[model samples]
Target: MGKARANTIVANTIVPIAGEDEGDSRLPSRLRKWGSEAHLSSAVARLEALLADRGFERMPWLAVAMLAGIGIWFALPGPGEWLIALGLCGLPAGLALIAMRGDDRALLRNAAVAVPLMIAAGIVLIWARSALIGTEPVAGPRVAVVEALVLEREEQPARDRVRLIVATRDPLDARPIRARLNVPEEMDDPRLTAGAQFRAKLRLIPPQRAAVPGGYDFARAAWFDGLAASGSLLEQPAITREGGGIAGWRSRLAEHVREQVGRFSGTASAAIAATLITGDRGAIPDSDGQAMRDAGLAHMLSISGLHVGAIVAIAWLVVVRVGALFPWLALRVRLPLAAAGTGALAGIAYTLLTGAALPTVRACLAALLVVGALALGRQALSLRLIALAAMGVMLFWPEAVIGPSFQLSFAAVIAIVAFHNSRFVAWLRGKRGEGRGEGRLERLLHAGLLLFLTGLVVEAALTPLVLFHFQRSGVYGSLANVIAIPLMTGLTLPVLIGGLVFDAVGWGAPFWWAGAKSLDLIIALAHGTSSLPGAVLQLPQIALWAVLACVAGGLWLALWSGRLRLWGLAPLAIGLPALFLARPADLLIEQSGRNAALLAPDGRLYLLRNSTSFSAEAMVEAMGKGAQYGVEPFAEFPEWPGARCNGVFCQFEAEGRVLLVAQRPAEVPYGAMVAACARADIVIASRRLPADCQPAMLKADSSLLARRGGLAVDLSNGTTRAVRPQGDRHGW
Candidate 1:
């Protein structure tokens, strides 16, 4: 029965309001009043003014994405007519219109939106094109010539490896190389600074996509994170120092903090101190990182949006509390304004010190939005402000949209804002009054309930998409997060910050000790919680339709009413059953020494092939699943022999019964036995055995490839059917 006004749609969904909940009645009323023409026009006018004055600020990101896309497109070795049509004609023509033409502000204004959208789309197309560079599977020992700037540096606890970020200098088609050097504790290097360049000759591993369906595509994820490739240093990548700008001073300050912590305690403690101040944890051990990830406290290791928000808020409180001592000064300046300005300045310094990571930048951006609201002397923040912040983010770096960190950070803020506005309205009503028989504890409990509800709603909204894209989800997520969050917010982080100050003062041992203790406590809590059965859920890779259906269903359930929400589930209903329809089969039957479609009996993605017309592509697509179940065999074999030989009937027996055979050295007990052990209920095999074996079925693949192209034979019913195959070979 509720349909949010368009303005409500923009406001409630786009930004974080301070104290609101989703189901609150007051928000809709507020939005209805705010959605009036006056407010809409005012907001629109402000946006226009900003666009008119500071339009140039928006060009850097678009230019970079376009320049990057064009550079990548041109780097491709061979492009056909359509590629040429798209690149030379379509792309250049589109770019020429957007990039070159600035005849009028009106034209530029329109192009501003259109041009960037095109650039974003072009970047995606280029990525696909680059992956599909070669006709056959690309396999080669790659020797990369990299002239790379050090973007990041860190230590790996597993192999005692030190990793270096090297942004590629060449305008060629390639990945940015991040190389790790196996540095012994015995050796010392002169260069460890940012802006240092190197020509590294290395044996490169582009990225291993663990052939599991829907497993985390670490390689693809890394691409949007500005990582082109990862490799090991072949000959200690040739190093040359380049002068860093003012950032060098911050890096130097960070180095000082690290040294002081090291002098007082140890390197690990020093790393923790450095991370608090400069967002640098390069020296952290791999074991610690793994423990953190496994325990679901890994987010603490990185200077994420939450960490940044905490730092800003904590710093603001510290400043306000201290500033109150000087009453005369407080009279002249408002605490909120002073806090906002100071927080921004400190955040900038922190961002610079930390090497300006993507997560850090996003958090800083969110903080900047809050600061901007204060600066403008606005009592009530608008969602348009948030949307504009997003626009700014997208304008400068549209690629952020693809990254998980970006989505989660933005979504959390949106959720918080919605909750804030909704709850504030409720609090303002009679709901919070003592006259209504509510007490302080009751109110606190209600607030806690609201927070938990919001967190659950967000997790539910995010989970399906997360599972589909990442193939991993925290199962005991709420419990894990709840335990870790208090530790993160209270003891561990604050003491870590204090340790940084202590380091500067030359007496940080006590603070470092306390912080380390907090870490230990957190580790203990995490280890306990993570050991709870079902701490994580590993999901299968989903088809595109599943992705679409889930998204549609999520939006419908979140935003729509009863009937509409149910209809949204239509796509989900249609997709899940359909997925089982395309699963890979356990036993693929065909003639010897020829190619055939390896059918998935359960209709999961899979492919297998031999020397002939049977393309192993479907089997390849399904390889991810097959790999887990050991579906791929070096030779051929029957689907099932034990039951079939004794009692079952044959669907397509050549000599009468099912024959279990393997063309090469393979696992014992034949394919049927292995598959049956793996819980495959049915078996399909070759029709060349004796007549005794019953309940046995077979399909003559490839022998009828020409006559029955795109067919799946149902041996149980003696029926043949046509089905278009979905394979990565079509255009992976």
Candidate 2:
């Protein structure tokens, strides 16, 4: 009886009795102990434990913090001296905290202080760089006889023009300035090369602002590039000096490549060949470029990470294989070190040959980092390396952080690395391992699957950025890349490079022909894919907050490890749908007040003027509809319901309010305009309005537009927004 009572006591200790459940009753004691430990005493303890697990893995977050700071700087309308001061004060405080935490066991204490300081440091760095690189742009339109030295020249075969970046002295202040000049190709002067000096009668204007809200900001890009003005020559320039420099060499090589390829193939093939070799994409036809963009293969034309990485990889492989042929050399030398050195040199040479554009420079830096890691017998690809490369770029060119190229390239790489390192991929790899005795066909199928999956991942990663910048994303890009990428990278590029090398020995014709034929196939594929149904997904202008949320969520997902990272889906869920939910404005007015577009009830755009100018195109795109939903002239659509038009003015009713548009006010009598205005709820006029011609709600006339820049109106709530508001002191 005593023994039975003891057995019952032991059972009670091991398992919960009926109706007294504490936790999972089936779990073993060992697992129960782990489960209990997983539940921390408090939220603070959990956070501390999380920080400890992510100690060194959190280093990449510093780069993210820096990017956030840089973004903050650009978003400010003014210099933000107060922000700089705050950062300066905060930096030392953070450092002091770290210094004081000498032997603290809490990792959260260090992380809590470190992250914000890094962000502050980023703010300070970008501010200093901006001040150092500041340039005074041309104040307004002007004509001057400018003597300048050419810094770079780009040939536009399709446009029959040559564009030049020239350094000249501003006549107004005698300060140095850089201006872009367009000259006709018909007057192509052999002397018009890099290092060439010329004098010309020039017409110069400051870089243009965005035509509509949320459009590309050319002025901001110009500011970062140190370009003060853009213009065209009034007449033929007189060559003052001959040209000779690295730029001249690059130009000549590009021409040679174009001519050689054109002789065997066609003009389009030649243009693509030149782009692949020298990164001169201006010569590509507009239609072809658009097709490439639609197919999501436009990155091929740029000398960026993909090209550089391929070149480095080829160099490394060639060196290792060739060295292995000689037993003595292979046995004595460290083949990897030798190959890495050779690959680094090859990457640098290629970068210089491609004009060392900003993207090329960035790629070269990354390649060098990879090569250095290989030489030291360390892992070549990691998020840590990516973070270092990004931080390097931001330190030198903080402005690039805002550009699409930098953001897209880095985002794609980050997504790829993070996805491949996930537990899901590891499980997939184990599944493949289980089929180790499978046939060659199985291996090929596996490779194809991996390629397709990678393409999808890249497309998914780049979609948000594409929509944020271009307002469109390719839907069929993953399908297209599954075929196009192999053709271009595996066949076309290698053959083209080999042909160029063989050209030095006068036996490259066959190789060049092969490359051209392969390129034609890829081009055809691009056209076919781009023509498919729903190839592109056009979205409205996404709000800045939505983009920020997406970026933050993406970083969180990419930077963290384990199931906790899944929490990032929350922000992504909010942001991705917000891309479609943004409401486009009902009315758009150009800064001149001469051009305007109204959103009709049927979701069609009605333009004041029937022209396909920049303003018209911008208005149509801003409506969040495709270009197929084209704009019709108000004069042609005047017979539609709730609308009437005469020679000088148009009257329309929108969202329960009447609108009067004075299109040709100068041609009409003042009494007629006054009478028309008095009956309307809002009046938009081409010229300044008289005080007596006031409307009930608003009067957006020439004077108002001049002060407000461009305007967008929401008719539902009768709210107006400006592209540039009063007191905006942005340099751009």
Candidate 3:
């Protein structure tokens, strides 16, 4: 009897009695003890225990997996036609699997089966989006007289680019096509503004593909944006008609703000103000833009989550307070619902004013979802809410999945939401009231500390994305954000919002001036921080596979809720080393074949000409150089041992291989060219190569470049492997 009683007692302790607490029942004895000892509150402990319960519900994880699958689908080369057939089959198969298996694991099995279906759906969406854009007309560069209505006009660094919706092509019944027209700086006319219709000769061609491998494909981006062609205006466009409606109002507003700000302040300051108020970034100098990016203040210029959230919050608070003044109204209307509606309206209005750019559209969608959730008495901030927002955005703008803005914005928000909901944060917030009654100074310090912590969290969350996409990480981003974000949010943005409101009644001059003053301070802060040593850390180019792997691991860590989520660390560990191990191309050539660059042994990019600064900057950044190297002009080439240049051509040795960039094929002596090629491993000829001058060396001519776009040579091993931006022209 005694032995049996002891055995029973041991069994009872090992397991749990009926109707016991789920936390104590589900968790191991060690975990329960740790939770108790760690001062975890009962509610937090229960929440965590619930999250850890694998059988509780795993729908959110399944949803996240589907999203990942979709992202992976788009990242691949092209949408496979067979994916549609697969999706059609998988949907029914998933249903059958769920129906046939009534076991506890049925849901998990079903979810696993559904992932490919989701990916297939994504593939279909890509195909649908592409089909929607339609085929481009095979038109060559020719002067065609067309009557075009300007949809938008932006000032480029050297020229003005205008987007026009064609009204009429004089001789041809051309479909209303969206064409990009470049106006030379000298030929820019004040009358050629958005909402104005003009009759002008346009020398246009179908959108061009990426010039080199791994280069940005403007043509692909244009296809998604409904741009049919790009061209130059033969002459200054004559304004034959004026704009009306919303477009006209926006154009007038941009023009008015530009003029007023320019009159009130210096050109640079005015440009800043215009950017803040009217979303006109055209006047901002490249140097200032680069400084802003380096200092991590670039987001402030763009209307993103920060701006959208502020507008909605302010509007909600105002509505709630005003409603509270009338108790009956507040009670009847419900302050939450009223405030949410007001906030949503404000967000929508702001989105429209900003032209509904991708980032702004995403913000608006997220704001609306949050506000709607609040109105519906649901949790307004959760991983589920973020997933919903992401899915909604991807459903409409699938192309955005590849863009940095979408990826970074969503990642930061998800990480923030997850962090706020973590056990550590919960414990910290609980400790807030544990101390003695704090003084005002203590309270302020606490607030500042919280602000700093938030900034740190956001900066860390975005660091990987910044490195992967921009190849430059902001070294002082946390400090910069702590200083600049508050000023922008608490002062500049508020004043700007109020100014826009007051401007309707022509009483916004003071507010605008105050906003401008705040902007000046923000700009100064960015410049100061950027001027610091090592403000930006340029990282070597990370391989696409590594980026994908990291993203997968991060998603696992963030989207799942359990101790098992720690498994994500495995992929992160593998991906980080891969980033360092990956090497960049040895040589880069522009699509035009007019300029090229070589990777120097001293970890610097040696440019053939300064005119290709855009490509050179990309190369330098990829090589982990924070600053661009000097371009060695042919006439003033450095008389180095491995490289030499003359008026006709430039040659350099990299990785024990010599490359010759021929500038003047016709002018260069044939024997000299042949001799140079005979001694070289690669020759990039800007002009046509003579048939008889062929050498054993690899030859890259205008014809090959035209077909390949841009060229990159990988001489990592003993052999030279060339890659093009457009990939194999004849391959799928």
Candidate 4:
């Protein structure tokens, strides 16, 4: 049988094991004999002894269970009555299992007890979120005349975009609404500053759902952010008032940095510097941003844990040194404590200055935790602390659990911590410690090896996530990081921070100049590495369940201790191969319905719509063809020599099937639909087609596209297979 059949067999086999009751008489006699009460009694005694010796290592498992529950909740199609029924049914069984496992006093320490409690708590968290932030849009899509205050405006090359807080949708009825607007480049309104009031006709629409099945979802993000809708201004606004406050201050700060830094750094470098310093990334060129992502230096573009940690470390060092200059105060006061306090203050100030984005907030929490631990003379970077930090984030922003940054940041740190304390790693270190050599060359080689190994470990841990979210792996990320991280972590961030302080004190020019130069080098490294052969690898889309399985297995490997840890290898083995079994669609149509692409047998992408370059680039990247490498429109950038296109339509043949794309009804060529009904496998018409032309062809018109947001067709098995927006798709 095929791999799919094999997986089905394994899933069928394992699911029963999870569902089987201990006393089920239907179980095989051999299994019943193996799982007799005597065996169960001995297992319980062993578990008790183990707990007595170790004093319950429950935090890691509890945290894992909670995280798993969150993942499960998000993966669910919808929160229906059945979910509550399922939970209600399971809760009693869980309670019974706990009761049978131990007495009341012992239940608190039992993993069996904690697992069910955490799962229920996670379900409750999701249920609460669903109640507070209902899945439905707050307002339907419609045109409205509104008076609004501009919260922020982003200056882009093509046009300017503004975030508005609507004071009233109607003149008589006042209500507050958060929205985003795009103002044309032709309109250079001086009154567009923060808190400036204006009345204009706007088309407000709810956040769009996932374009394709398993695609990006703006609706969830919008719900969390309390964004009512986004739209464009119909005409010049009638100004009502001038503005001031925090929003105004931030705007001025952004403008000042842009003006001052642009003078010395040039527009490109200055844009990068401004984003790092102010968290306004609208000015950064799309090409540069693409390079950063492709080269695996996208982390540097944002203010994250690494940047926050560096800032705190520098603050701590500076405060400690300054204190040393005053011997009297240094002797009387706890210098380290004073330094830690200073670092904590610095972290909080920076977080606020940068708008306190989610990543920054998470980093600040961790930095504060470290400082607090230091003040109390305890270990700062322990597993328990990590668990607590994760729990805290989840308690406040449970939805963040699904975000890429949260997953990547937490996974990297967890892997480092787990490996740093592992017996296998300890044995390796011991072996290294046995060497007495301390030559310069030896030290250099050792450092390089260590960096490479660390990168390998992090990449290994992030593989499933990268493939699931991005579909492309940064193959040369370690090499790129080796050259780029020290420059960023050591020089760029510090110089930038120092430059900001000096600028405030009227002595900043030279520091900003130095930071700009550092950025240029980093950008150069990114471009060079990304241009290297095999620097990025695209993989087939894996199902969410498979990704979650990989996560579960990884957590087991990282969190479990002793012999049980070995079992993690089983899931890892199963999950990795399952990824290959789920192949990419042979053809994909973007949500726009007007744009589509086909996957050539040799792994090239042939786009249908050449006009939609930006969205096409994104689609290409999501398909594992790196933006810089993917083939464009078959007419211009031919990947399939036989592909043909004209002014209004394009046609391509793949896997013995002909697919036709028509930009307009007129492009159909009077009798083409008649031929398509019998000859062509699929016809995608952007505009309405004549009733007679719709004969029996697999017609994908606007109506069909509305129901199935985007389309993915596969013909690898000599039969037509298609994926719709529904969760019924096999892979994703």
Best by TM-score: 2
Off-target runs (Cα >4 Å) in candidate 1 are 1-151, 167-192, 195-201, 204-230, 236-298, 377-383, 419-432, 435-447, 553-732
TM-score of each: 0.57, 0.89, 0.84, 0.83
Candidate 3, residue 595: the lDDT equals 69
lDDT of 1 by residue, 1-732 (tens): 145577787667644562467666676767677679678667655655655664533333343345334433433333453255344435544654665444433434454555555554555555464454422211334565667676555543334555655556322445334433334333314364457777656655444332222333444445444444555655655667663655455566667666655654655556655666676676666545544554545567778766777777777887799889999979988887888888888777667667787778877887788777776787434444555565566545654554567656655554455445453446654455645787789876765565556556556556655555544455555555665676667666787677667767767677767766655566666667656776654444446566556555543343333243367677767754543343332333332313233333343432233432213433333332322233344332234223232222221222233322322212324455444323322233322322222333433323333222333333344444322122222221
Q: What is the Cα-based TM-score of model 1? A: 0.57
Question: What lDDT tens digits, residue by residue, belong to model 3 across residues 1-732?
Answer: 999999988767755643345455445766678778677546544644454475423545544544555565544444353455456647776775755464544444455566656666666665576677644543555568777887776655312444344434423545667777777776666566666788788887777665445445666777787776777778877879865666556656766665655655555666766666556677777677777888888888788898888889889999999999998897788899889999999889978886777889899999999999989998888888887788787778777887888888888887788777777677777787786687899877777777677777777667777787777777787788887888887887787777777889999888778777777777788889988998886776677778777777787777665586788888888876786576767776766677665666665556566544566555555556534534243222234355677767777766677777787888878787778778877778777776655544567778776666667777555433333333332121
2 or 3, which is superior by lDDT?
2
Angstrom error at residue 480, model 4: 2.7
Candidate 2 local Cα displacement, residue 488, angstroms = 2.0
lDDT of each: 0.51, 0.81, 0.69, 0.71
Ranking by TM-score: 2, 3, 4, 1
Model 4 weakest lDDT span, ten residues long: 723-732
The model with the greatest lDDT is 2
Q: What is the lDDT of residue 500 in candidate 4?
A: 76
RMSD of each: 16.0, 7.0, 8.6, 9.4
Badly placed stretches (over 4 Å) of model 4 are: 1-35, 47-57, 85-89, 92-94, 97-109, 134-141, 155-176, 188-191, 424-449, 578-582, 628-633, 636-662, 665-683, 687-699, 716-732
